[model samples]
Target: MNLFVVKLSLCFLLFSKITFGQETLEYKLNIGDNLIITQVATQEIVQNMNGSKHEMLNNLECDFNLIVTAKTDSSYVINFSFKRLKIKTMSNIYGELMNVDTSTELKEGNFEAKMFAGLTNSVLKMEMLKTGKIVKITGTEAMIKKMVNKTGIEDEFTKELMFEAIKKEYGNESLSRSFEQMTYCYPEKKVSVGDQWTNNFSGNLIAKNTWTLKEINKSIILSGKSNISMNSQEESYVMKLKGTQETEIIANKKSGFPELITVTSNTQGTSITDQMGKLEIPTTIKSKTIYKTKKYVQ
Candidate 1:
């Protein structure tokens, strides 16, 4: 009876260690650390209008870099810049709509090329907390000006119009909101395997995300599920959508930066257009996105 009791206690101790071991996860980077992240995304959109189905395809690929320039006890100041940008779009109705690659020489009169090229030269400065929250972002005004100048539009009014249009998507507020979806995944407290937490993202897309720590080994594995809603309006149309997204991430244990991340989402809703006499056209979109990151040395 004594032997049995001792063995049972030993088993309980082992089980507790395996189940409740906690680890702190946060960004741990030093000044001069450079991280290069490449993202690839593919999207398919289907719309039913006037009893006909139309489909569009979009493919996007880009490389961005983050360099830690300064660090405080609680936060890091980083510089973010786009290294390359490429986009391709096609539709059943329009065939090939636009293709732009910043790596290649731009065509003289290609507006899309001129517009996207500007991103490669612009840098955004951000102050990010060690807990993965972005507290402040600057340089959007200069970035927008550079983008507009790349277009070579001589009229000040045209440049102003372009600047405002671009600001909706690339302004300081917009960038902070968009980047939070990636940077705001960490919890304030320590976590063990199988622990779960919740966060949120808001912008053109609003998502409530639930994340789980699946495993901790050579690399940490995390998974997430998000319930998303989107609302977008332009001069002539408005889009409303609801969807679900699934995400998987492999993150470096030391730096807390993602090594690889993948996400899949499906959304469906309606498009209301003035041209359609306020008709509600059924629309659906499916997308897959992948991000790969590595520390750059040199």
Candidate 2:
């Protein structure tokens, strides 16, 4: 379920509060406003040489939802914990939040946060309900677990590396695939847009990464890359990272806000390249955020 890993990364990250009673939420983090973690899966297709493949996309896309609450009591800090008990083989997608906000700064205060895992990459994240700067990181469980102090994660594998892991564990046919979860946080990001930052994680996985914020149009976009690989797919699982993803939010007239995020995942791997047949995944990838924000408060 390589698609599951990829979609899990996005779905877990997008599991915000929706107002219309859908999987999304619109509630502001009040003193006790709760957050829900949802993982959405839909039929996935792999680009082929001629066109695309859509054969067994049946119930392959399974989605689950859960509720989470912030444990932090301050507004100027980042904190969260991955409940290892949630899933034995999966991680949260909180590492991606680092890109959502890069200008966070931690003031004098104390903070603690917690993360939970649901089946199918579904997980929840909650920080101290803060009216000040709130950092958000979104990624898989591994990344989410190690990301900043906003999130942290270390990976040395590619999506193809992950594909091979799937082939090894489940045996080819392309039935299931998974990868390390990623997490990042900016408890305090107050640098200018052009400023750069770097961090590292060491544990079951070792990872290093660099990041920069570029203000395009009127939005401050987040861009960065991590050296991820298949360190030990031996008896466990591994994910072949396609590559770095550059993302930006564009304004949606109908939504009255930037509800769309155009993400370009830059990666180069044999399997990914071969999947395209003759075409290429392009040096830059172009994808969209699953959900758009109707309104946001800083």
Candidate 3:
């Protein structure tokens, strides 16, 4: 399920916890603060058209180097570095469609993607990557490639058009369709992980998603996790996901952001056998990240 939403979110890559700089950390993001994004996705999508449940697993490590511009309005120019990118699963693990229990770690390799946008009045510019992530994953990761293409039009449209696409995509109602839903919202008067915020005015966080808010210099930080139930006609499913997330906070002198968080997350999931349980193969996503956001810009 987590993989489902993360993959679903590929259609929409956006950011910030609303109040902008004011997160768990009491301080406001100054010019040097950088916004970091580390995503760990482990999905086991098993569709048995032939009355068989097969699965696979994917473990990838991605990191982004972001420099919060001196001008707050200008979005940070980030160079996305794919660290430890690999594919592993018990089965053939051929296509994006996969089912698995354990994953095989691969040799270390590097890939890259870059995005340039920060606090622009134009939402679209913020939505579209400074470059295209489409071709990058297409041949190697076809399933994800489909997702990138199916949604988020970054074509010849003006900057304004791209943003409009993002808003409309997020606003879609189907986004909430998930099992054991854990949505993240923020209270009106400055809230943190322990605080309560409704979906409507949910700070910068959208509704029906699992959010990880750690304190970066005493401010609420924005991170996310999501679980999605596959399109299964089956009635019963035994699902299990065990993983790890390591977090940190640092004041990056270059960006001025109060924290550089790294979530070294990895998990393995397996569905207990049950005729009534429909959820299929379980998987784990391993991620190692380094993100610096501006909270106290020196």
Give the winner by TM-score.
Answer: 1
What is the per-residue lDDT of model 1 for residues 23-99, given as tens digits with 9 covering 90 to 100?
A: 88788888998999999999999999878888999999999899999999988999999889999999999898999
Every model's TM-score: 0.92, 0.33, 0.33
Sort the predicted structures by lDDT, highest score first. Answer: 1, 3, 2
Weakest 10 consecutive residues of candidate 1 by summed lDDT: 289-298
Residue-level lDDT of model 3, residues 1-298, one tens digit each, is: 5998997676455334444544332222344444444434443344333465555545543333333333323222222222222333444435543222111321122111111111111111111111111111111122223233334336645434544433322322222221002111222245444433322212121233343444444343545443322222222444455444433444332332335444345555555456635545554435454444322324
Q: Among all windows of ten consecutive residues in candidate 3, which has the lowest summed lDDT? A: 129-138
Count of steric clashes across candidates, in order: 0, 75, 40
Per-residue lDDT of candidate 2, residues 1-298 (tens digit): 5988999877766653232222111122332322222222222223233343312221111222213333344432222322222111111222211111111332222121111111123242323223222233232333333222121123445434543433332221111122112223121334444556665433333445565655433443445455533233343232233444443434322212233434333333322333334343212222222323333333
Off by over 4 Å in 2: 1-28, 32-189, 200-207, 216-220, 232-243, 249-298
lDDT of 1 at 266: 99
What TM-score, to 2 decimals, does candidate 1 have? 0.92
Cα TM-score of candidate 3: 0.33
Model 3 alpha-carbon miss at residue 120, Å: 22
Q: Could you give the C-alpha RMSD of every candidate to the true structure, in order shown?
A: 3.2, 20.9, 17.3
